[model samples]
Target: MLVDLHSHTIFSDGRSTHAEMVEAAIAKGIGIYGIADHLCFHDNPWTTRLDQFEEMRSTFANLKANTTSAKILFGMEVDYVRGCENRVLRLKEENHWDYIIGSVHYIGDWNIDSNAADWEGKDVDATYTKYLELLEEMVDTKLYNIVAHLDLPKKYGHFTDIDFTDRYRAIGEKILANNMAFEMNTAGRIKICNEFYPRRDIVELYHQLGVDVTLGSDAHHRNNVGQFFDEAVALLKEVGYSRICYFEEGQKRYLPL
Candidate 1:
């Protein structure tokens, strides 16, 4: 069964509405699909607007009520910002989300993943170090169920010079310690990264660590709901993953490969 729980809508940086995405997922034969729009600090360029956030909530309710062919879950992809744990916790309570995908999109106001060309003066090593630090903290807080796009900074060919294997190992350990799922994000297949998030070697490490795995297209468009999933599954199988996970109402379920 194809179960995907990481995607966005027009409410955030995505291109399709919830209805269009549902149609796409159904066509792809997905067993369970979720709409996980960005619910980050209001300052980010891709964050959902206040009014759109409310509208999407209603859309989620309607979709959940109406969807019968496939399970529809309401999820949030939140950006972890230091010193904003209270806000994040409050938002979690307010949303009553089915699952939350925690990600680090910013490091001290330097939006590393926002653009690659703009990274002229940024210290590549220092930047990723800070990201991993925040990731460790996020895991410790137990504020999210899945870690979105692990090692996303490698996207856009920006980390070619940096070797963050140790950092990634630490991040993997934290995810395992905190009982969070490691997301296998297929969006990287289309991004300049030219591979999945966490890379194959890192994924193998996670498999060795016995971390629970989850897959996400990170699709922003309707047509992208389950894109690149076959390749992702093949990679997972090669890495020795026998089961994959999906979440519903914050509960994790494992599906055999």
Candidate 2:
């Protein structure tokens, strides 16, 4: 049974509605599906608001109540912006979400998108350093169940000139210390990079550090649901990960890949 823990819907930047995403998951034979829409952040114009969150939550609950074939877990893909702990805490307190995935989509003042050429001639190492710093801060919040996609800057080719192994190892140690699972987001294969987020080497390092892993498609559309999931499982297996993590009632459990 395969479980995809990261996905989005029309409530945020995704192209499809929540029901459509769930139906697509069913078609893929997924045993579990998590609806993680983008969390509201100060810089991003596309962030979800409180009312939208409640609406999405109610919609998901209603959908889950009517279904029995596939388990649907409600979640949010929170942006790891500076000083985002207060918002996270409030959301967790008010909602009964099954999981929360903290992700870093921006570094300092720069946003990561499909445009890699825009970052030309910039200091790659400094940018990564700032990003890692934010990652460490986010992990310290202890508000997220999983870290969405480590080394996401690679998506924009920012990490090409930087050796992020040692730095990532340090970050991995912190993530392990916090007992938070790192996600292997398969959406990258279809993104500008045409590769998995964090790449394989970073995943291997996380495994070496004894950190647990979760798999996500980071799907923004129905067709993108569970994209490249089989390959993600194969990668995890190659890295010695026997199972993938799932969250329920603010706790995590492992499921076989």
TM per candidate: 0.95, 0.94
Residue-pair clashes per candidate: 0, 0
Q: What is the lDDT of residue 115 in candidate 2?
A: 62
What lDDT tens digits, residue by residue, belong to model 1 across residues 1-257?
A: 88898988888899998999999999998988988888777487589866675677788899999988899999889888877789878877877888989988888777777788868887777777778888888887888999988788778877756777787788788888877898999998888878888789889989988999998999989989998999999999988999998888788888997
Question: Model-by-model lDDT, in order?
Answer: 0.86, 0.83
What C-alpha lDDT, on a 0 to 100 scale, does residue 193 get in candidate 2? 68
List of clashing residue pairs for candidate 2: none
lDDT of 2 by residue, 186-211 (tens): 98887666789778989999999999
Q: Over all chains combined, what TM-score does candidate 1 have?
A: 0.95
